[model samples]
Target chain A: MDPVGLSGYLTVGAVLFVCGVICMATKRNAVGVLMGVELVLNGANINFVAFSRHTALGLDGQIASLFVIVLAAAEAAVALAIVLNFYNNHLTIDVDRAVELKG
Target chain B: MSVPELLNHVLHTDLPRSVQIFAPELVLCVTIIALLLVRMLKWHHKFPTSWVALFGTLAAFVGVFAQFMYMKTGGELPQMRELFEFWGLTQAGVGTAGEYFTGLLVHDPFAVFFRLGLVLFLVLVQALTILTGIPDQEDGQDFYTLMIGATIGMMLACGANNLLMLFMAVEMMSVPSYAMVGFLKGRRLSSEAALKYVVYGAGIAGVMVYGVSLLAGVLGTLSIPELGSRFELLMGDQPFSLTNPTAVATALGIMLVVVGLAFKLSLVPFHFWCPDAFEGASAEVGGFLSVASKAAAFALLVRFALAFQGSGEAIQTLCLIFGISLGVVSCLSMTLGNLAAYTQTNLKRLLAYSTIAHAGYMVMAISALMVLLSGSADPVDSAACVEGLMYYIAVYLFMNLTAFAVVAFVRNETYREDIEAYNGLSAGGPMTKLLCFCLLIAFVSLVGLPPMGGFFGKFAIFASALKAGSVHWFLWVVLAIGGLNTVFSLFYYLKVLRAVFILPSADESRTVEIPGFNGAYVALITLPILALGMSWVMGDLTATAHDVAAYLFH
Candidate 1:
């Protein structure tokens, strides 16, 4: 079988992006929100790689995908570190508890 | 040349010049490494990390100065006449000539000038950190390291010439700031602020990257300068259509990208995290975010908006759409900011709202810029718009920093942040009164009163808005809103002053005697707020701003 078309890959990416955004909006767990962030980033990554393969966008797309992966990991590390601090202070990872600074 | 030959040529020919242009960044990177090493080796015990941070920042400032001097005088030490010619730092004879790092970054006058500003700002913030004792001796190295790391990111953001560079630069700047916001470890509010900041920041960044993917895929390029011509080809003379994937994708991508930038600028509808972060974090961190992050974001926004070069009809329409929408956002941000600030009792939260309002003011200049560009005539007015932005940022740095510094100082002495807590500040005697006076000056300057720096900044922006109003009638409305918001802002800023001098403290024990050095520090920072307002001295600032605007257009 031939490889999937650009539209197919884009459809998959769009689904993932939507799921990720919805997750970010709905999740109360800090780590769950982080997972949503990763999903959104990877969704974008899939689009970048697909473009590099199927379209005239050459190495730049692949390079961008690689960067997205690295930066996603970096973001996760930082988010988790913050989560650890939150857990330490409140003994919970529930973002709802982190509202001491509200108006 | 063949592909391999082209790659080889870029590697050999471009690499050396890129390093030369990146000298200041190199200094900052070296400083970060040195700071870490000093910490691991316990050198910070003998030599303070704050000193190391300050020394590194000063060195970077000197590096920028040397480059500027070299550009101006062709590497020769200046004689008296040449010195006179270059004095007041007009950026005379400095063209837009730049060294490019392949496609990553460009070292132009705009980049250099902002880098200079960031480094100078770092020097002062480092001093403030030392004086305020935000970073105790045990953690000084970590604090300075994060601070310097963030500065490097900001400098890079100012010079990013490619989409990849832009994303990386923004992340680089933001990551350290997240750490800095939570730097006061074991504090409940600090960690909460960092969590909120990271979640929101990471989510927006992902959205931005998705937008980037769509844009780059459709356009088949990530080089910003190349996007314009490609846009002209893909969008030229095309009527609006939902059926056109290219057009829809481009529009979607642009709006998504703007969302990311707006989050950083803390414009309304995307400004939810700003006040919470400010209220949770220390005043020092708040000041850093308000000034440095906002400046870098404005720089990125200008570069992104201006990247659509040339005079194609399709491009002109796109510019107009951007202008009108930006105007609406500006109006919303200022009105919301001023109204929300009215009932706030926390000083930091109030300033955060003030920052949002000021962002609205700055974005008005962008709208003016776009409106002027849509005309494709009167490039001078557009340059004035850019100059207005640069000038506003320059003055805003001092005005906002001084306000936050005063807050940090008083918080140190009294551990209070509420307006009601500051009752009868004038009754605390001369030192306390002097601090009160400085706060008054800062608040008045923030209100854009005469004889203060903010007046000139606001004046420059409002003047450009009026200039653009000649071409587009809507900008007159933007000008009207800007003027009205300035009046609205005055009530809240002065309420702090009134609390300080007018309202009497019911508890006499609340008044604390501030030390002489802290009062002197307050005066030191406050002096520039007055100096930049003087007519004769402001000539240099306008000249510098003009030079930067000219270079950007080039």
Candidate 2:
């Protein structure tokens, strides 16, 4: 009856979580990191729906998880849009190069 | 039933309350499709296309307003049910839906209030776009679609009953905005802004997702109301107690979830991309990004915070710590934003920092929200903070959009967009100068000054902090600093106002004619700035804020 079988979902979530961490730590594409965020959300989303099916707490788990996924997506889209415009202006996709306002 | 048959069954028959609760988003979906069809037509001039976009928003606004007026409340049922509603679902607790959309969503006052605020802002943004004519610059079909689509995503973010829905709504809103950020594709700074926005967005979103996984895997539920119910049931003696390892893990999940949501709100540590993106993007996009998006994110925050509300020491301690620290960090953000604004000669970049300062104000309201919910606080005091934040955001939509309208107006003529360019506006254009003075008052309001709603907004939050008696010093210090910052902010506002009214036009011979529609639009926005002084109109805000407090506190 365990949809994620605990460890399987855990492993997927772990991989996604680590991948997102790695993406945030390493990627310079900006939009690529956004994709990584989407992946991380998908991983977590898998866990939520999985748990909803598996546990006594029932549908609430899946519902809250659904809200998280939607908000993350909205944030990502706007951020990516902003990044696209930023790159249009700055002529670079690299994050380290965007420190002009730091002073 | 077969797959298509079952799908039709859910579509054709009675809709659950959760779907009805999300009615505004449903209306927007219809508008988006209509906009998509408009993209095919070759317009002789772009004004009609823009009108289609504008009226589409107006229509959507009407729909949301009507839905809000007719919305059924949970805990108490409405006398009658509407034949049509969000996602085609019936009203919750009033009509049935197999535990409210199979427990992936709920129809509560909390989500409804947030959704109403979001729709109001969306209408404002659409109206601003119409008034300003930002579409005059390019082929703008995709622009309108993306704007509407992103807005729908924002509404969904407010009502997401399931984590999966949350992620989907977030992406639905994010993707279009990414494209929109880069919509002015030829501009160097616009592209740079888009890139920075995307990177920052991805990083925070990823962090939040990891947080989500932790919550779901440990606590085994993603449904918010159910999570609230189960977390309440947990321990049977003391609620939300982590002393039981399972509860502890759930508590940890809640922390991580806060991290994800905070990234959206642009709280410290996650606020890096805001200034850059704001600076790099155009004024209209920047304004939209700053206000509408943040309001939606706050909707998520309010819901999630209440979801974890319990009688446990650990959870309450977490709330208290976060609330207090967020207050200090908010002060820092405000200082940083104002100081940054002072040095900027470019009007767009200056407005960018102003957006940051406004964000700090919103966060300040949120921190107060946390304090009010902790049961240890007085109920009456909590009500002030709740109402204050709600009214602040509502007034903020009108005030901020007015400021952006001025920017758009000036930008349209001569295509120059720097503070220096505004130097001669007064002599050349009287109406523009008048509008600039009105916007100056708006700036004053944003600074939380009197005769403007911003003053009461600030007063309410400060009063709540005083009433709570827990963060007395923090509140007083913030007030002192906020008062000082208001003075500092006045200098820059006056600087812009002087350019518009006191200074001579760079060319003394030229006079600018005010277009009828644009003039009326600015005039329309002007009324509310002064309305802030009327206590009768302002009195309702405190009551509404109390309702917001009651939802979370109850």
DockQ of each: 0.84, 0.42
Relative to the unseen true structure, what is the C-alpha lDDT of residue B16 in candidate 2, on a scale of 0 to 100? 38
> Which parts of model 2 have CA positions greater than 4 angstroms off?
A1-16, A29-92, A97-103, B1-21, B41-47, B71-100, B108-110, B136-138, B232-252, B471-484, B503-514, B548-554
Per-residue accuracy of model 2 over B110-138 as CA lDDT, tens digit each: 55566676666666666767666665534
Model 1, range B1-554, lDDT digits (tens) per residue? 89999998687756656666677778888888888888899987898888887888887877667666555445555553354243322222222255477768876767777877887788888888888999998888788888888888888888888888888888888888888898886999889999999989999999999998988888888877777678888887875355777877877887888888899999999999999889888999999999999999898888888876558777776777778788889999999999899889999999999999999999999988988888885677788899999988988898898899988988998798887878887888678889888888888888999889889989999998898888789999989998999999999988988888898887887576888888888888888888888866688888888977876775
Worst 10 residues of 2 chain B by lDDT: B90-99
Tens digits of lDDT, candidate 1, A1-103:
2466888999999999999999999999999998998889988999999999887688999999999899888888988999899889989989888878877
Query: Compared with the real two-chain complex, what DockQ does model 1 have?
Result: 0.84
Q: What share of the true interface contacts does each candidate keep?
A: 0.77, 0.64
lDDT of each: 0.84, 0.65
Chain B TM-scores across candidates: 0.94, 0.86
